[model samples]
Target: MKTITSIQKHKGTTPLTVITAYDALFASLFDQKVDIILVGDSLNMSFNAKPDTLSASMDVMLYHTKAVCAGAKETFIVCDMPFGTYTDEKTAIYNASRVYAETDAHAVKIEGGIARAPIIKALTQNSIAVMGHIGLMPQFVRSEGGYKVRGRTEEDIVTLIEDARAVEKAGAFSVVIEGVVEEAAKRISEAISIPTIGIGAGKYTDGQVLVWSDMLGFFQAFQPKFVKRYLEGATLVQTALDAYIKEVQERSFPQTEYTYQK
Candidate 1:
């Protein structure tokens, strides 16, 4: 597969496919289909490490990015710039550079818009492809009050549109529109020359993305309304675990055929 930078060259002409991946197993599996694999900081919540992504750090992201990159031979890996790691231009560029150097990722994704343009420009100028993220940014969940849909009001719609434009003008190869009104997302996609990847932002986007764990049913504690679970791996895993425990308790496991004869 081509690098994300190469994929960006086809923006507006070809759809870009992406998915979140934290480990080699999933990365290898999705690499065949996805053009980009995002090592998202959502691992903090998904792994039960913390209630929000704010607790996630660059080290944590790099560890998972490395694991994903190990098996992702085809798909371009884009490591996420975790919360707190990119609050300003100086820090954003510094941390973003670190991610590229450490994980050898094809690109890095940061949440925000106009205010983040400088950092995005710096990364891109330094040869690091940057993917912009806007609309209900999870990194600002606490500040924003919670996980809520954006672009619902006239003011929000205008802000979101401007944010999208700012990122594109600032040199983001592509942008992700998440948890925004459908009409707003469609408008942004139409307005920007770069491909717009959406999650709960509607079907008019150039492409779509989802948290792999959420889609695979690995995360059962909570499910976002916009996310559709395609597989129930959680239930299957529980059933298998239960059977294993029962067999062990009843001494039915490791029979002669399953064990080596000494």
Candidate 2:
């Protein structure tokens, strides 16, 4: 099983591959192929059809976490601490502790920076490893208006660096630098000791991650410029469904070859 030590060891050598998986089917498919399987709250949009991750709840997140855990025994699992689950240090610890105890997840990820450092520290101190999220925090997207690349301004880049530093100092095992400028992401990766996983942050980080549905073309509700579709999943599903419907209407399905023989 890949652990914190294994993740840490990949810093300068190999680039890690991380992807999101919320249920058994997807998790099982990603099992040994990926370095990390994040039970992401992106499920709020991908699975539940919610507006954003802010609407996701702890119970919902845990339900998916358990499913992923069941499917992925060896891949490192990191469960997202959904919005509102970590409002304060006490609440954060309680929720983080819940993830640690209730599931086989190896770590919990929470989005933020200096303000979240104390919470991260508390969780790590209590023996729950944490993965910090910086750059465009979906939980706080209301303030940013919408999803836009960060680190465009000099001040923003400085703040991002500080945020990365704060989380590392707080004892986070790794950090996800999302939706930031390429150069800024690279600088932050070089500045930090822990592995930096970039989402839209560019090729400079130690590793990269993407939402499972986005990469597989299963989701197209709101396409981000960062996601690269690896397969035409939605189109394929539609074609298959269309064929089934046409065949069933034409009484062409359940052919003798497909029927069970007694």
- The positional error of residue 23 in candidate 1, measured at the CA in angstroms, is 1.5
TM-score of 2: 0.98
Candidate-wise lDDT, in order: 0.86, 0.93
> What does candidate 1's lDDT look like per residue over 39-122, in tens digits?
998888888558889988788898999999998987888898898887776787788778877876888899998788887887
Per-candidate TM vs. native? 0.94, 0.98
lDDT, candidate 2, 151-182, per-residue tens: 99889899999999999999999999999999
lDDT of 1: 0.86
Top TM-score hit: 2
Clashes found in each candidate (C-alpha, N, C closer than 3 A): 0, 0
How many clashes show up in model 1?
0
